[model samples]
Target: DIDVLASSEDAEKVMDHFSTLPTVVDVTGKGHTKTSVRLKGGIAVDLRVVSPEQYPYALHHFTGSKEHNTKMRHIAKSMGLKMNEYGLFSDEGNENIPCSSEEDLFKALGMTYIPPELREDMGEIEAALENKLPKLVESKDMLGIFHFHSHYSDGSNSIAELAEEVKRQGYRYMGMADHSRSAYYARGLKEEDILRQIEEIDELNSKYKDFHIFKGIESDILTDGSLDYSNDFLKNLDFVIASVHSQFRMDKESMTKRISTAMDNPHTTMLGHITGRLLLSRDGYEVDLDKILGKAAQKGTVLEINANPHRLDLDWRWVKKAKEMGIRIMINPDAHSLSEIAYTSFGIAMARKGWCEKKDVLNCLDIDAIKKFLHN
Candidate 1:
């Protein structure tokens, strides 16, 4: 239960009950007035108490986006009022004044109207004037990364280096999907090499106890509708991100057929870089997206939102359509270097453009959820 308290005694009672509850307890007390409680079964509760004159305005300011609160606070200060979670105060020291509502508070501040959805630092102040702010997904909300490459393929970093980098970037986990055997030009892994790599990844896990590394492969979809590796090999990996590497010139129907066969496989957890399209360099493949997305949704496979600047394929234009059709996306940076990890932001930007939420991205799942999706 979420309890927005009005007194310190009431908050103490709730905290006392919650502290003794089974499972877990996390408390964040910012000051005398603001205390946040996270319960054992994943419930978050916050409590605050303020003077009557400051209550409504304080409530709105606290339960707002950081961007929204910052802009509003600035506007309030310009009008000689101080705003914070505990209360709003007149800069002129009129403690007996009565400001009872959020609308009234903003009106007193003399700022134009703003929407909550657009309060994500996308120039909402200017947009609020023109009424054209875009709601964007910031980089911090993503839980994990789906597709990444390393020294195993044409990538420039080692698995340990890549894992450390993602951890430093504050992600829960990252999946390593170096190229498969069919990508011979990139020195993709053979079965023996893959086994060795998995062992190494396991060894690394033993070394770093706080994070996880998924043993995934970016398996190529052959021209004739078959995956690069045998089914037994594919099943052994944690996840398989299948993509079109060569034979990029097939006709529309044949191309569709090739992808269809792979999507039919339960072991193929995701379809990589749909359309195989490069943003400005090369023309993307000509497969029918509607048919592909439909099959993928039905087969329970994810579609990769390739985050490399050159190949932000899947266009994001079609992402809304895919989401509406019930197809989940895996936001992948296809990272090959430390700097490339930031590409996850690019993917998030595109996902927001497509109207995707945190739940819509498959990689946002916990490690257990990801494993469940792969094995199912």
Candidate 2:
């Protein structure tokens, strides 16, 4: 459900206006404190009348993960205060304490302001109490974007077109990882094709002083746990993203072994979307993430948080665990179109939800540092 904010005076007007929109199919609970509406595509939305005086408290309560809100309420109770969306109140006389902002609401509870992304109740409250919450990674921290595809491999744009567009969008570098030869459906690249692309990249690099395009491929991990290309061939690329595009039904143990073996390859720079889940369409293959996470930690394998909305794999929870293990996260939009490159914002959201700091993300690396990292 989507939460919409409106003042008491404007709440009814907002709902009436919203109900009249062409996209809205039905409305319910009209003229009440809250109204629910069904959009054309079956999406549900709620418009809540959070009065101006209590707006901060309403936002804090409504946006927080249920567990986080519960923990906050428990803390308030311990302090002899009652807390709700309206405001924090004294238990004795129901006297409301005023809060001008979410930060003030947090301060009243003797805690530091918690960012919305980190409000998962997974140690955030405790960290806030100790004034030790991490400064989460933001979209501005990224200097480049990875996992782009061009027309050479099932993508909509050509290399030159994609490069010019990505450069104009303000990133210093654009890393392209088209499919390797094994993905016939995508017309994945052959060795000669990769060689040709490298030469093209070199020519493109000569045109601009501030930008560089990294030659890379999304190598398929075969059933036997080997990458699509030979190590000699793979080493030619600036980076490699090893992913599983087929064979999603292996038992947990075999799947785990398959990914673990790939992670051990020094040429395998990053492991893409640890689970092959397609959001609402399909379940991820059975794989032991514990083993995969441990393997990545041991070998310093970069775990990719695929930023495609359908696959936010290497899910935020796992991203957090990997971060704690000193694993580096590369949030790739897995973009197949120019518009999809902007999906980096979604990846940053997932990374922030995972409690990632600037240092925890690979995209935050400077050009020199990233080049060194790619070589390693």
lDDT tens readout by residue for model 1, 1-376: 5757463345455555544556437775545555677777877776676666666666566556788788877866776777776566787874533556765655455544444433444455665556453344556667689688889888999998999889998887889899998899999998998899999999987876667888899999998878888887787788898999998999999999999999987678889988888866789888988899889878877888999989886777677778778889889999988999988878887787676767677867777787687667
lDDT for each residue of candidate 2 in 1-376, tens digit (9 for 90 to 100): 6778766666777677877899889986676677889888988888888678988999888889999999999999999999999999999999999999999999999999999888889999999999999999987889888898899889999888888888898888889999989999999999998899899999999998998899899999998889998998887889889999999999999999998888878799999988988899999999999888888888989999899999998899999999999999999999999889878888899999999999999999888889999997
Q: In model 2, what is the error at residue 125, expressed in angstroms?
A: 0.7
At residue 201, candidate 2 shows an lDDT of: 91
Residue 98, model 2, lDDT: 93
Score residue 161 of candidate 2 by CA lDDT. Answer: 87
Best by TM-score: 2
Q: Could you tell me the lDDT of residue 12 within candidate 2? A: 70
Per model, how many backbone clashes are there? 0, 0
Top-lDDT structure, candidate number: 2
Error of 1 at 135 (Å): 8.1
Clashing pairs in 1: none
Whole-structure CA lDDT of model 2: 0.90
